[model samples]
Target: MRLRNCLYHFAPYGFHATWHHLATTHHIPGRIESNPSSLVRALDELETARALMLPRAVAFAAQRRLQKREGRRVPAALHPWDSWGCHDIAYCPDPQKHPAEPLPVVVDRVLGACAAGTDRAGRCLVCGREDWDLWRVCQNCGVASGGRGAHH
Candidate 1:
């Protein structure tokens, strides 16, 4: 019943391999009916990921307000691939290549490379693993058919 209360406050992050990775990594039960509290582990992972950035977001908000006062009404430009909210970050199946950092940081590092222009002229977003089947998972990083890979 307590798990129900916790979940009622949040929406499911949606279905994807990344979601499954979260479930497994966070130790969420393979079957929730047998152990409902394991669901909280999943929620806790989401919360921790989200929490990692709250301070930085708060700082950005304050900086934006200060700029508004200075007649700098324009906001800092975002990278072309960056929308105003969450993006679909990828999960690598191979544990060794999997992103151990926070998802947001991983997104920044991966997409940031693309935004900066790269030496790899023909290669796709994941770099050396070149068979980029657009609208399909990355053969290298397991990124789904969305976000930056959609364009690369």
Candidate 2:
């Protein structure tokens, strides 16, 4: 789960390690990694492994919790962070300074301060349109005759 979170949060950097760990630890029986279908099938069922395994972990923990409660302990209700420790995944980089990096659109807008004349038109890597006042269609597609897509 820590591996999955690392992969999910850090993306490209941690993916290799996460993949290696997953491939080694949770390898499916007689499956080939080269097969996209096999990979897809395994990826699709990752939650099933969690569904099966987590309950058992929780149950075992629950027993400890129960005993602890009886032993004058407060029952830990399994806070979401309990599984992964104190690692709260947060967007570390300031998007305003490094807007080139791909980001979650919602948070990206906030971090990039989208309203401070950070026009999507100018930031369009495909098109180069600085003056948002004059152009409705992007420069890449219109004036520049470039074929970059809408979001590219």
lDDT of each: 0.46, 0.33
Question: What's the distance in Å from true for residue 51, model 2?
Answer: 1.9
The number of clashing residue pairs in model 1 is 0
Best by lDDT: 1
Candidate 2 segments exceeding 4 Å error: 1-18, 21-42, 72-152
lDDT of 2 by residue, 1-152 (tens): 34355445332112343244335434533446444454444354443333333443455567766787788665543222223311211111221222222223222332233235444444432233355322233333221111112113
Q: Per-residue lDDT for 20 in model 2?
A: 43
lDDT of 1 at 116: 67
Give a tens-digit lDDT track for model 1, residues 1-152. Answer: 44344333321221343455455666666576876666767666656644543454455567667888999875543322223223333434333344444444554455445546651343444433565643445555555324443444
Clashing pairs in 2: none
